[model samples]
Target: MSNRSRANRPTPDLSDANNPHAQKAQNFGPSAKRLFGILGQDKNTLIVVFIFSVLSVGLTVLGPWLLGKATNVVFEGFLSKQFPEGTTKDLVIAQLQAQGDTNQASMLENMNLVPGSGIDFDRLASILLLVLGAYLLGSIFSLIQARILNRIVQDAMNRLRIQVEEKIHRLPLSYFDSIKRGDLLSRVTNDVDNIGQSLQQTLSQAITSLLTVIGVLVMMFIISPLLALVALVSIPITIAITVVVAKRSQKLFTDQWKQTGVLNARVEETYSGHAVVKVFGHQKDVQEAFDEENDSVYKASFGAQFVSGIIMPSMMFVGNLSYVAIAVVGGLQVASGSLSIGAVQSFIQYSRQFTQPLSQLGSMANLLQSGVASAERVFELLDEKEQDPDPLTPATVAHSANRLEFKDVSFGYTEDNTLISNLNLEVRSGSTIAIVGPTGAGKTTLVNLIMRFYDINEGSLTLGNTADSAIDVRTMTRADLRSRTGMVLQDTWLFAGTIRENILYGRPDATEEDMVAAARAAYVDRFVHALPDGYDTVLDDEAVNLSVGERQLITIARAFLANPRLLILDEATSSVDTRTELLIQRAMSKLRQDRTAFVIAHRLSTIRDANLILMMEHGEIVEHGNHRELMEKQGAYWTLYNSQFQAPAQHESQTDGDHI
Candidate 1:
């Protein structure tokens, strides 16, 4: 079905060899089942396609039969030209029998020739016209069938695309962390697209090819059972060839697609980290890697196509042998007057029709294998377990439910590997709390739990109007909880849009005056006024046209625009210049006012004035107090704080004493 072997075809990813989806398709049976499941949703349309296909194929088979009738006319006209005038067919047979020509006598008895009649041109013309009409009607029906099939395929693919999008949204962040982004994208885009193309290319043709064969066989039998049997003999040979070639080609197809993914992944990696490659001077290494992957894909594809190409000629070989047998056998019968020459001619045509479709099916085998392999890859994604479903009815919470608490919270990313154990903490509605720790100290993990980016294995994370009136965070809808919370990370995200629109994304319905106020609060207005376009300056891809500090300020402005009840800042000023850092700190201070805030800081000095500070170590809270109180105790917080300020680890004690 897909004739352009060199053209880019769908390559379902197999880069992750251990992934369950990497397995290749083994049979058309499963592909048919999956395709039918999608088709069944529009049963009425398929019924229409089936009916038209039958009509189309029926007319196609009728063409040879009509041509046979025309052949009979011409043959009879020639014999009638030789017959004596005023002689009847009965008299001719009687005369032939008296002459001792038994075969002639038997043939004369079957002839429909009229005495003294020349060629009947009018009758011949009429029969010829009917043959043309049958073929023409068949073509019209085929066109209609094809049009409807395309529509059905397009609609089915649309539904599938939507399903993939929704599934991706429901998948947890951890799921993304576990797999290559490229592989997942292949499942979403290429795999689904290939399924649609494969179904569209193969579905109607497969149906038509099948129907044509059956209809032609019936016609052959009706004309002469002997010829039909001769043609039928090739079917076994055809099946054996198909099975042998298809089995091997399927494996090659798998290798082709697998290597395609590898090549694609290498390309993605090279381009994504081109700067790193350039700095390290590894361009030649990347080029070599790409060539290796590309060559593997090429060889695999060539092998699959070459092996599959064998089936076409193999089918033709069998069909030609059958054709020779039918011609020879029918000629003998015609000579004996047991069968007409026209019947033999029609049988020859039927033999050709039968083998042509068989050959086509052989060709479709490779395309079908590729398509089904992609379908299986996509199906695996669809079958993945979704995130925990939302509550049928969420528990209601008061408008002022901002006070946060974690009670008896014990959780881990995986079972048997607890990260936070028996954690307990509570915060008032309006408090700026800071969490400081080294890497892997459960600081960000704690923030992730609060934002519900991940559902904890065991924890009671709740928010309340007051300390005693708490409701579980899970009780509220995700949208509802997130709507009241906003976050700004150290690595800011600013999309490709105007500065105004970027800020407006946080609160779409905010007035212009309110937007400017937030922008001013985040010091975004200070930078915007300096630019020629100010608020309307369009950012480029990844907003790369702007400085990092400028991008960071825009995000902070966006968060401020939302006026969220709860705010989370991941060391907002850690990557900025000193002046920008001070500006951001002031902006955050204003934004955090009257809002419950959690600031995860890398620099301990930045959170010196926070209402409370928690020093975390190995998922445990080692110290908790105001900055001055912790410094007075000279414990874990004091030690960690002094470490950052110390000249070097070798002179840590004196630095600690001096700082204290």
Candidate 2:
């Protein structure tokens, strides 16, 4: 097929009703207004931007008017010579004189001598110079405006990103638990970036376009009211088309950005788990999911771009039609001696100028709407409920005594389905308390409450020197409550940093000697010396460079360095082999020596020597005793112990997905 033939073929249907990006619809106006409010915070810079923009636009608006004067000077002489039917040079001169313009009439008569191409070089040069000067000033002002706006936009975006970063810490862990990491990442990075770029491009341009539209219309009316009215014919039509098309494209633009975020999420998740996908032979499934997301993004972007692309051409068509009508009417008025030839030329130029800003504004509206959508997403994140408020006079623990008491504590992820209810416990300072249970028991939930990760739904959890004299945990701030606590979880987390750095994170001000002592205590130094860089070895993404045991050792070292009054170790050695498990057990023995600790373990062997053991089932402790006492009872604890030794493999397989 020829190029023309292919071009003539209709565009494909790019809209998708079933698209994931089409989940929600929003209004851009309020978001846009809110965005403006945010910008208004930097009122000084905004005022300066507004001043430069006005100066730039005001200077540009004078170009056509001045050039029109020069054109009128040249044509006044020539038109007088080409007198039509009843309209003569004498008649025009008489009319000018009659209007008390003797000085202009005298100038026209003098310039008529070289009437064939009667362009007064002196006067034309003067007008051209003035036009050039105006244009130059306009350009300078525009450059200044752009630079200021870019600075303002970058500053605003920086503040926005910082706000999001700070908000993360203030938000409840439950919010993060429910939301995806990739989505939050997109909000902090991609969404904020979209707003920055769009604002940088649109702020000055939108203002200039609006100002130009108004300025051009005013000039047009001054030039010829009759021709201005003709140009006005398409104003409502152009606006109507822009408004209707823009409203439809607003949703499409929002979908496009939303798909962009979704696409980012898919890429982030896929790449992060690429090895798992390949190992499990699930590459095809992953690819299929990615393809579906990619296609949705394409369709949404195409629909948005195609619809927004309509505005420019539609406005151009209306503008051109208006131009033609103005030209015809101006010519008639000129022929009837009601308007000057130069005035007609200026009116036509102004008409083009008028439509130019309208078209520009139409295009800018699309970008503004998209920016607002991103702003709304960002604003939504900012509006999430923060962690409970801090107390006016927060409770404090005496350095010597940090006893914890749970009196009728109860909580659940939701209120209707309570996971732990009517629970009570008392823990002495500097003692190890083992919480043991079958799979699905609330052992871990109990620890989470102790750390204040979740507040109790009922009753009072207090901390003090003695159980009876304890102050409610709620009276103390979360930061203060968690500060003296140390935790090591089943899954070890190490960031992309040196072994020393990860350890130092637990106690940033710890001395080098203290760090080495903690590492030695946790047996981390045993393996660290074998690595090429010793303690300075940098971990890769997710710390995959280290073995599971090595990573667990690093975490134990972290806890040891913290040396907190309270320690919570949850399945710290559950997944390691026999040798590594023994190494971790030794470290645990050292760390738990004389420290107030809550140990949650699946392997009953690790907790056999715990000072006190509470065997939990469902949400309550079914049996409580020392290891020997529980073993003698031949109850839940005895059955779980016998089962672990009887079928170790079966026990692990059955409890693999257990919450506790």
The TM-score values for the models, in the order shown, are: 0.89, 0.88
* Clashing pairs for predicted structure model 2, backbone only: none
lDDT of 1 by residue, 422-460 (tens): 899988888989999877788888887888877777769
Residue 326 CA error for candidate 2 (Å)? 1.3
User: What is the per-residue lDDT of model 2 for residues 1-660, given as tens digits with 9 covering 90 to 100?
Assistant: 111111212222113455322334347877788788877878999889889988999899989889888887777546544544455556667888999887566655533333234446788889999999999999999999888888888888888888889998888766765555666677788888888888988888888888888888888888777777888888899889988998988888777877777777778979877988999999999999889989988998899878988998999999998888887887777665576666777788888889898888888877877788788778877888898988988877775556888888887776666777898888887778999886657777787788877788999888887875678989988888888789988778889889999999999999999999999887889889999999999997588778887898888889999988889988877656778777777777777665788888878988888889999887888999899999999999999999888796777777985846
lDDT of candidate 2 at residue 324, scale 0 to 100: 83
Model 2 root-mean-square deviation: 9.2
Question: What's the true lDDT of residue 488 in model 1?
Answer: 84
Q: Model 2, residue 164: what's the lDDT?
A: 88
Model 1: lowest-lDDT 10 consecutive positions = 1-10
